[model samples]
Target: MSEVTERRAAGSPADQRLPLLQLLLVGFQHVLLMYGGAVAVPLIVGQAAGLSRDEIAFLINADLLVAGIATVVQSLGIGPVGIRMPVMMGASFAAVGSMVAMAGMPGVGIDGIFGATIAAGFFGMLIAPFMSRIVRFFPPLVTGTVITSIGMCLFPVAINWAGGGKGAAHFGALEYLFLSSLVLAAILLVNRFLKGFWTNVSVLIGMLLGYIVASAMGMVDLSGMDARPLFEVVTPLHFGAPSFHLAPVLSMCLVVLIIFVESTGMFLALGKITGDEICPKRLRRGLLCDATASFFAGFMNTFTHSSFAQNIGLVQMTGVRSRFVTVAAGGFLILLSLLPKAAYVVASIPPAVLGGAGIAMFGMVAASGIRILHEVDIVDRRNQLLVAVSIGMGMVPVVRPDFFAALPAWMEPITHSGIAMTAIWAVLLNLLFNILGERGRDALCGHH
Candidate 1:
């Protein structure tokens, strides 16, 4: 094993402790970086679930609590359930689109939502052992394609936020650009001018400055902040409990499968980026962590939980590979979630502000993928098809989301997802063309 892998195998423990101020600051930086993404799933799902106003509000709170718990579990190893790498967990953006589709379904109400998510988590857990076998397939070539595709897929979402997000009548207006640019500029300026700890949270500092400026200009709104309670008891499966029928369970089963594949690639990407050798054991542990979080998120009234690539980008950029730092952040997130007012403070980040930072952070995730693939030897002509086919398949959902409209509603979870399609295609094709050899499939296996 490499030196990096050796160090990671012995993951950091939080007991060693740090200065109170420094630890608190790092934790806050993590919350700032991931708040938009963590809340997005609930915000979108709450609307689609036709939840009452108060219920919608609770959903957001639930998401925050669950996300914090998930991050802590992921960062600090728990049984077979953590990668012990510097991965930060949150509500997966991958599951968001499918959750929207599921919410719009006629019979699958919020109960169905819970049931499906729970089923998905279990299904994802069941497959971890099998999926870990495919880790070897993530050569540089494949990782690059997926990472680049990830960035490409997220680019529009970021751009939309930069323009004040979807449905803005004056989308792309100057005010929107000014705010986003200011935030972006703040991040850059901090990186350029600040030293030590401040430089580490350049993005967070920039965002705080933007929020202050926006508030002074009357762009920030806190009228409803005082109305929210500072504490709300989190009840598991608070929406009348999960009603697991055949179809919804089946629908989410596929969702979990896709999540597994996507996460495998992500873990591999992280391992490669950190110069850690991701063996089958490590991948096993990582996926186990995902499954636990997925299950936990379902019970807590949220969507799937997986590592966020954006924070991985932050790690790469900051060059701080300590899992201990993120564990501190996770504690902070949980504490904030416990305090409703504090959670609201984070929940109140304008989507547009998030959009600006999101663009930078999410784009960095995709970039990380590209870095992984750069090491692959793709010069051979045969390897080109692998990239071409996988990429083409991945772009389907991106290019035409409704392309599979005619497919059964149950199939929406997999068919409509470019990420899933790409993952399946890449894995299958690798086993086909790359593993079996060109024009020798039938010759060797005698089964074609």
Candidate 2:
């Protein structure tokens, strides 16, 4: 047998080891894929709290540091804490609306946000075992519907990036469109002609080419980067001691529940991509990692952390299933957090370029979901109704972010999240039409 084949046969794809260079490059590719999202929570929360430029920068650094630590623990794992999957951890955007609200409260500022985060993290950890039991509900019917909704929800983010990012001065500029197209074309060409490693790094190569073009067009901004420090360690509690309030803690706990639902879908999606079965035990580990990471994030001056769904697409596109790639990516995140200049350089990659890659990657996620659905008894009327209605419900928030604004404030956590919405409906519908329906049939037979 071939040496490569022998090596692959020796371990599960998730445990396979690659060459050091491949590890770094592939890991960096994962990093690039997720960096935009990893920093977004801090950026939004910082601005919402009216933090100054330096304070925001501090928040970003703290977030990166915590994210790095979380990702490593998740991928490498320590005992029962991590899932040991190729999962990248990042601050959860699901918490943004709640956090923004908390930021505006009279006494519940950033400190209260952190305090609530800590409480919620603890709450999540406590309930993770119970939540993991929900895996049985996610047959192909529910998994496919939720995964499809995830990709569909992300499409708007991709389109906005293609238009030069939301709220950019040159939003929808022709240059941004051209740049996005160029990057997309490059990626397609690489995937068409390249083999093996080249194909795996296609997105990275496309982004690099786009970055060069953007630099020539004066779109790669490096202004004021030199003024930033050469190195700095993220000091925990930089925002001061957290002061918890009952209301904020409860709100954040709701966000944690939302995160758990979202992470379950993401973990299952990754499992589908990597050919791993996300058994209940494994799901429990993944949830524990998320909870532990978020708990630490509160003290480390960051927000809640969850498995990043976008990276699942990269794994699907690249066909690299090694969890260590994420370990290396976590290492890079640590370095970036320490070296402000390095982080800025990576941050400079135009959103247009990312948008180009995102179209392919995010579309792959949707495709994977459809592939899973292909295995379902899709011809059955009940299953068909389940998939159709779940996905439609999932799109409500994506189609109109404020659709639930008129609803009570407490419902925001579930209503705002398309993944959560999809999962909830799909599970309930599955129980109604499949599990409970089967029991009803048995009872009728007994009566007869």
Candidate 3:
């Protein structure tokens, strides 16, 4: 084995310890990296449920609190729960459509949503061991396609941010583009010219510069800062006691399954980046954390929880593989949840600024996928087809989300997400063209 591989086999770099200042800065960077996504599901669901402004704010706080706790558990671990990696947990967007549908149902309102979420979380924990076994199907060919698809899937989000965020009054403005480009340029410059720690924090430094410039241009919106309470605690069952229904519960279970698949790709990607071998045992533990977090999230007035894919890219870009950084990040998230004013300040960061960093970070995820693919026997025609078809299947959702609109609503969880689609197609294709094919050839040889 190579020296690097041997070292990785000895121990995960994710377990490494860093200085207090470094941990805080890097941890804060992770929090900033995923904050928008962390709160996005709550914002969408809150608005959809016709919640009052205070109620929506309450939902955001609850989401952050649970997400912080989940991140901590996933990084620090509790027995068999956490994966003990640099994972940042957040509310899964995969559950949005289901939860929104439940909100619109006459008898199943926010209460029903929470009930279903809680049920699905328990179901997820039960099935996580089986789900982890799917990791065996994800060889380099499949993993690369899935990882590349993940990055491709996130590109539109970055583009939207670059254009001043979806539904912004000044969407597509040149100023937004310039600011995003400036952040990207700044990150590149820092990564190129700097060394060691400075290079590792390039994204954070670039974002700081972008935020300063954005503030100077009067783009930062702190309009409602004074209205938000200075301090508050997330109250469980804030939407009232959850009332479970079969349909909503089933729908959420489907979303959890999709989360497991998508998270599998993310975990493998992180393992590849950190040079840590993700044994099946560790994968199961990570999924269990996800399940347990989601279960508690229902009570906490949040949606399902999963590892944030965007942060996977940040890991690749920054090369800070320490899980403790994520633990520190969890601390910040908990602090933000309790301190609304602090959360608002972080939230006020313009989407344009995040877009700049997104371009680099998200692209790094795709590049890492490609790097893994480099080891595959790409010269073979079957492997070529496996990759080509799976990636194309994955892109269907990204290029045209509505392509699967005609499909049954029950299939939305699988169809709407590019990562999920890629995973499905890649696994199936690998089974058909590789595993089964190899078995068939061996059987024929034995008969001969």
Top candidate on lDDT is 3
lDDT of 1 by residue, 86-105 (tens): 77788876666667776887
The Cα local distance difference test for each model comes to 0.72, 0.89, 0.90
Once superposed on the true structure, which residue ranges of model 2 sit more than 4 Å away at CA? 1-10, 439-448
Of candidates 2 and 1, the better by lDDT: 2
Which pairs clash (backbone N, Cα, C closer than 3 Å) in model 3?
Answer: none
State the lDDT of candidate 3 residue by residue for 1-448, as single tens digits: 9433465577769878798988899899999999999878999998888899899999999999999999999998888899989999999999998888988999988899999999999999999989988777777778878898888888888999988998789898989999999999999999889899998889999899999999999999999899999999998887789999999999999999999999999999998999888878889999999999999999999999999999999999999999999999999999999999999999999999999999999999999999988867778787789788888988888888899888899899999998998899888877787778855443222120
Model 1 stretches with alpha carbons more than 4 Å out: 1-23, 97-108, 193-196, 438-448
Q: Candidate 3 local accuracy as lDDT?
A: 0.90
Cα lDDT tens digits, model 2, 131-207, are 99988777777788888888888888889888899867979899999999998999899999989888888998999
Q: CA lDDT of 79 in candidate 2?
A: 81
Clashing pairs in 2: none
TM-scores for all candidates: the values are: 0.87, 0.95, 0.96
